[model samples]
Target: MKRREIVEKKKAISEIIKAASAPEKDHLCLFSQFRHYQYKGHSFYLKSGRGDKLSSILKHHIQNILKINMEKVYGSEWPSEEKSKRKEMVSPEARYIFIYETANSDPNQMSESVGGRGSQTVCANDTETIVGFVHFRFTLEEEVPVLYVYELQLEPHVQGKGLGNFLMQLIELIACENRMSAVVLTVQKENLLAMNFYLSKLRYTISSISPSRVNQLTGPEKSYEILCKVFGVEAKAVLEVIFSIANSAY
Candidate 1:
């Protein structure tokens, strides 16, 4: 990319973040069908969340879910990782899609009524309960505008029911709708299930910026790998191919 082009791209990404961060209905409205999800006998609805606006109830759920799912994976590193997660969850730029299990008679009908941007839609009833969440943000990765997923956690009871795949598909849709180059996330190398889910099920590739792709020798020492599903040739070059050249230089 040319210097001027990179500058323009950065400006564009900044504007996207600003607009998405605003308490208004816009890009999300483009895909209203994804607001509700039903799998097996379970019915759930998604709610948009801002890091700054998280209620005590939501915050409690976030922390509890993270610990339940990640403590064993992080092991000795969990204490510090937990602190980091707490701080990241509160950043003003952090955006969330919270999944709540609902008691509504027909979830298919709920999907018809809910809009994309939660700011414009009231969601769930008094009987609905929280189940899982996906935390993501609109930001730049290697000067390319992308949606970075910070976390995707589900309650233990909901695992292995294809809900993870459904949520990821929704996230990818939102990324594409917003003109993001790709959907990016990090996964611990120790978490085999998640790695297989993203790589085999979702078809995401290890990003060029991932430690292993950047330097195979020392990269394996890193506990995590960055992964992405690129949308176009430009994103593929910057996110998946750039490090191939970088590795040669190393």
Candidate 2:
């Protein structure tokens, strides 16, 4: 082969290596940009995680957020006992909470009840405080990878600002990057606002519904719906755009 042709071939290989090794700029961009929407003087910022101090400020306000939804749906305070039991059930398979401390801890040293693969926590910045959080868990089902939105909550003061929709879009992007076939989540039927948010705006389809018969004997049986969305086509479309941009740069 001619020397010039050989040199050009080496350069093309180098470009491919550079693209594969370095993280995409879009990943960082998503984490940094917040689609701003305001209510009164308060502004909202949706992003993944936050500094330790900011997370601390939002911890106490979580209950206030939980209480608002609980009251509206059940006409009573969220039952601490029931919440504990539910946490205990899932603890065997995954840690219920995700934060710096939990993430930094050694998996072997942690209790069997805590920790799971691909679990992360994200915070929503509201003015000077962190007003909400979302917990994500990724798992493989029947050899196909899927991302699960285990939990999402916003402080009572920050609701109705369109932050939830923004966060959902971010989750979808992350799932696409990870090559997940679909995103799945379970929500209580009583939480009508959440039900509507997932179904109407996010385009999630209900896959199943299970009612708690055990709880029915004691009081009310809470029904839960499982929802999922396939992302194969969407992810391919996004990757095509990224590849086109990289090719243009070369």
Candidate 3:
């Protein structure tokens, strides 16, 4: 198919969402080999999951990880930022790949129980040890289908390992498999480590839609920047190129 046609078809966000969420039997089957990863004497497994199916315990785990890692970055806005993060994490459209350490761990014990807002049936017996998680979703950006990574939080103990890079590679593969135009994510300017990781290590460009690129004056006022790694000509044109300047921010 022509690049224009692909971009035209993806204009319908519903279709992209449907295609991405349809693979229910084995969501990560296309990238099965990535499910297992080892680095720095640490072994871990990635489990595909949905936001709506997150157990109360898993929700707690995600919250704790985000706090420990992002509170300093968000500073005084941490409270409101955390609230937004919680809501986004439970959206039905959100998808996740949870990472768990696999040393002497029973496969059966790593089950996820379904729970969400107002879910009173909390599973106190849950004991899965999650070291990190990648939250993402299929969404429309500049009228093109793309995968937006909402969060990539890891425990302090696991920060220096190559796990972050490996997970991003898997995310890119998933984006390609789903015919996504690009892999997009936002990074706080204050978080220099994360900014360097995406911009320098991953080579993701500062998207044209990013606040910084949108307007040279007010752009610097924004706290974060949107970055993307585009896949095709259509994606590059719509997401990476700056055709005209307008009063907008992404």
Candidate 4:
């Protein structure tokens, strides 16, 4: 986005944040707070990096859940002697995390009954068992402020659920509310499953800075792709202009 448009959008989003009834809506789960966005019957809780306790849990998840996926993409030699490179990647000290929770619901009870949602019946301490997490931070890409997704890791048990898409929608909502022009992330070319999930399911496009786009000759050898979803009128217009210039140069 142009500088002027960015300023205006930030101002608008700031207004929305201020105008909202509360900072975040309460979820049925006991301990989550900050921001909540529900989609397709799933409740995703987002919170800024909290304490070292949360950080430890995040690292544990990355070690057990994300390491395999990373090895699949980056090559088999990626693991450390300890079997996890998470010491470097999953940094809850900086970015916020979007948490997918586990609610041990009893099938015996009707969801519609007075007992209500299973989440209400069970006291869920999110730190102990996190189904999945997405780490993201606000950043500038081509002069446009965006939410950059560092990682989106889910436990195998939670993999097939619609929670992934729901979490992304929640991220987009966050970017839209923060006055960001888009949501962006890096995906390894070798990780076809993730590439298809973002490109086909989420409708994100290969960004101009993606190794594939910036330098095609060397691009094919690069491991990752930068993908983005541009939003708002002004942001889209700016991207079109950037693409036109880039295409002409090529």
RMSD of 1: 4.4
Question: How many clashes does the backbone of model 3 have?
Answer: 0
Residues 1-250 of candidate 4: C-alpha lDDT, one tens digit per residue: 6999979876765554343212232222233223343444544444444223345665676566666556656665565523443543543332545454534233233122133222322224655655566766666676666777878887766677776786787778767766678888988776778888988788787787777777879986887888888986655644323552222111
TM-score of 3: 0.83
Per-residue lDDT of candidate 2, residues 190-233 (tens digit)? 67778778877776765422123223354234556566677676
Ranking by lDDT: 3, 1, 4, 2
Reference-based lDDT, residue 218, model 3: 97
How many residue pairs of model 4 clash at the backbone? 0
For candidate 3, give the lDDT of residue 187.
Answer: 92
Whole-model Cα lDDT per candidate? 0.80, 0.49, 0.80, 0.59
Could you give the candidate ranking by TM-score, starting with the highest?
A: 1, 3, 4, 2
TM-scores of the models, in the order given:
0.86, 0.52, 0.83, 0.66
The per-candidate count of clashes, in order, stands at: 0, 0, 0, 0
lDDT, residue 108, candidate 1: 48
Residue-wise C-alpha lDDT for candidate 1, range 17-72, written one tens digit per residue: 66656655433456667667777777777767778888877798788989999999
Q: In lDDT terms, how accurate is model 4? A: 0.59
- In candidate 2 the C-alpha lDDT for residue 127 amounts to 26
Compared with the true structure, the alpha-carbon lDDT of candidate 3 equals 0.80
